[model samples]
Target: MYTLHYDSPLGGILLAADEAGLTGLWFEGEKYFANILGPEQQERETPALQRTKRWLDVYFSGREPDFTPPLHPVGSPFRRAVWELLLQIPYGQTTTYGALAQQLAAKQGKTRMSAQAVGGAVGHNEISIIIPCHRVVGTSGSLTGYAGGIEKKVRLLQLEHVDMSRFFVPTKGTAI
Candidate 1:
């Protein structure tokens, strides 16, 4: 595995990639920072890492990246499915966990799916911004459960031009 360090406007970010693509991106000191990396990781800038840096550059400049870098997030099949859905969230839009659960249920051909379960998968997303996990919110528009911290989540949404009036930081909740 190869890694690169980037100085983002919000904070320092550590990016990880391998032959396939970017495997992880985490804010310094954020929950689950580098959690997906194996012991054999090295600090070297690969093509994937460089491309990711460019993507971040566009993003931090307060504009949506016109392109997405290759991402190879590691997780279970269910988690991967959830991450795929996260990627579909529009650049400046937000969706609720319950809504995600309903979407997953329809995709899986089930009558119902648990919002808590969807939240669990969203919480464990290792790819962060590129996968757009920060776009997920609680049913009431509560900005909660971001492994990168709620403040960062809020900043990212603002960077994407999401209207902050619709979302609120929960005083008490998971990952608060």
Candidate 2:
């Protein structure tokens, strides 16, 4: 496995990858700091990592990046489904957890899916900005449950010009 460190407007970010693709991207000192890889790691700028850094550069500059770095976020089937939905969220748009659950329920042909379960998968997303997990909000348009920290989440939303006036830091459910 390989790792690369990127300094962004938000803070330092860690990127990880292997032969398959970009495996993980986590904020420094985040809730799940580099949880995707084992103990062994070598810090070097590989091709994939370079491409991801470029992508971040464009994204942080307040321009919609036209490309997405190759990602291989490791998770269960349910989590993978949730993450896939996250990618569909446009750069300047947000989606509610309950809405995602409804979509998943329809996809799976079930009566209903749990929003809490979707939140769990979103929280466990190893690839942060690239997978756009921060784009997920609560049913009431409250910014909730970002594993990278809500402050960072708010900054990301603001960076994307996501109309933060409609979203607020919730009084409950991991909004810090």
Candidate 3:
């Protein structure tokens, strides 16, 4: 595995990639930072990492990136499915965990799905901004469950031009 450190307007970011593709991107000091990296990992830049840096560069510039780098996030099948759904969320838009559960249920031919289950899957997302876990919100449009912290999530949403009026930071919840 190869890794690179990126300094973003929000804070430091760690980027990781394997032979297959870009694997993980996490904010420094965020929950589960570098949790997937093994001791054998090296601080070296690869093509995948460079591409990711370029993506981040465009993203932090307050504009949507025109391209997406190769991503290879590692997780369970269920988590992978949830992450896949996350990628479909548009740059400046937001969706709720309940909505994602409903989408997943329909995809799997089920009548119902638990929003909390979907929240768990979202929380464990190995890749952060690129996968867009920050775009997921509570049923009432509450900002919550971001491993990178609620402040960062708010900044990301604002960067994407999401209307802040429709969302509020929960005072007592998993977000805290």
Candidate 4:
């Protein structure tokens, strides 16, 4: 295991990578990552990890980045689908967790997705803003569970130019 930390508007996030690719982006990294690393782990240079940080910088600046690097995502199939779908969420939009689950479910001819399940998956995303999980909101337009924190979610959405007026509107058709 190899690791390093970088600053983000959300705080310092720790990144880890192996030969497989960059594996995780952990918020409030120093304590979180330190606990998980095995003693044999060393700090190694990862161009992929570095590139991910650079892309995060672009995202914080409100410009979507073109991330073509290898991402070693660890999750169940449904979770992977949710994370990939997050990528399709154009930079300046928000979608409700139910809406996202419904959208994903439509691919398989069903309209059932548990907000709890999707929320759990989103919470564990190894990649954050670059993948845009921050775009997912409560069905009521409430900023809900974000591993990075709801305030960070608000900041990210604000940076993406999502109007503040929609911040807490929970109409039935409200997006994520």
Candidate 5:
């Protein structure tokens, strides 16, 4: 695994890649920091890393990026499915966990899928901003359960200029 560090408004972000493409990006001190790469990881700015940095630069400047870097996040089949759906979330929009579960259920031809299960998969996304796990909210429009911390999530939404009034930090649950 090859890694590089990017300085963003949020703080230092660690970017990792391999022969396939960009694999992981985690904020400093996030809950799953470097969860995908092993100790054999090396620090090198590959083309993928450079592209990811440029993408971050545009995104942090409050402009929607025109392209997405090649992403090759490592995860189970279920997590991959959830992450793929996360990527479809528009730049300044948010969706509920229950809504995502319903979509996944429809895709899988099942009657129902649990919102909690979708939340677990969303929480485990290896690529943060690029895959857009932060766009997932609770059914009640509560900002909840971001592995990178809710403060960063809020800032990311603000960066995208998402309407803050539509979402709230839950008073009695994991949002705190």
Candidate 6:
């Protein structure tokens, strides 16, 4: 894998690539990913660095990622399916994890999955903002469990012009 560091308006970002194109993106440092993967990502994530960095440049600039470049996010088949489904989500729209799981379950003839599973897939995505996982929210429109932290998730949502205030859960039993 090839790796590169990208400095965005928010912070320093890490990119990982391989023969598969792009593999991972982390706002945390190599040390953080290394802790997660049990080896240094920078040591292995050295192949798709150039292309991934370029792709990120386009995304942060507000253009949609062409996604023509190679990508290799590692996860369970179900998680991969979830991630692939996430790709179909448009640039500025949102969906609930329950809704996504329901959409997939509809094809398999039973509602076998739960929103938490979808949330797991969303949380484990190695690629960030570009994959547009920020578009997924709680059924109640609350943002939850972003690997990049709520602040960054809010920033990304705002980047797409999604009003952060609209997502805050109201006080207990407050009227609409």
- Tens-digit per-residue lDDT, 74-114, candidate 3: 99999999999999999999999999999999999999999
Which model is ahead, 5 or 6, in terms of TM-score?
A: 5
Best by TM-score: 3
Model 3 root-mean-square deviation: 0.7
TM-score list, all predictions: 0.97, 0.96, 0.98, 0.83, 0.97, 0.82
Which TM-score value belongs to model 4? 0.83
Better of 3 and 4 by TM-score: 3
Ranking by lDDT: 3, 1, 5, 2, 4, 6
Give candidate 6's whole-model lDDT. 0.71
Expressed as tens digits, the lDDT of each residue in 114-160 for candidate 1 is 99999999999998999999999988889999998999999999999
lDDT of each: 0.92, 0.90, 0.94, 0.72, 0.91, 0.71
Query: Number of the top candidate by lDDT?
Result: 3
lDDT of 6 at 24: 73
**Stronger candidate by TM-score (4 vs 6):** 4
Candidate 1 lDDT score at position 156: 93
Superposition TM-score, candidate 1 onto the true structure: 0.97
> What's the distance in Å from true for residue 108, model 3?
0.7
Give the per-residue lDDT of model 5 (tens digit) for 33-144: 8987888988998888989999999999999999998899899999999999999999999999999999999999999999999999999999999999999888878899
lDDT for model 3: 0.94
Per-residue lDDT of model 2, residues 1-176, tens digit only: 89999999999999999867799999998898888789888998888898899999999999999998888778999999999999999998899989999999999999999999999999999999989989999888888888889999999999998888878887765937
lDDT of each residue in 1-176, candidate 4, tens digit only: 77878887768887777678777777773212334355776676678877877877887777867764577776689888888888788888888888787877787587687767777777667777666788888776677677666666778888888876856633332221
On the 0 to 100 scale, the lDDT of residue 162 in model 1 is: 92
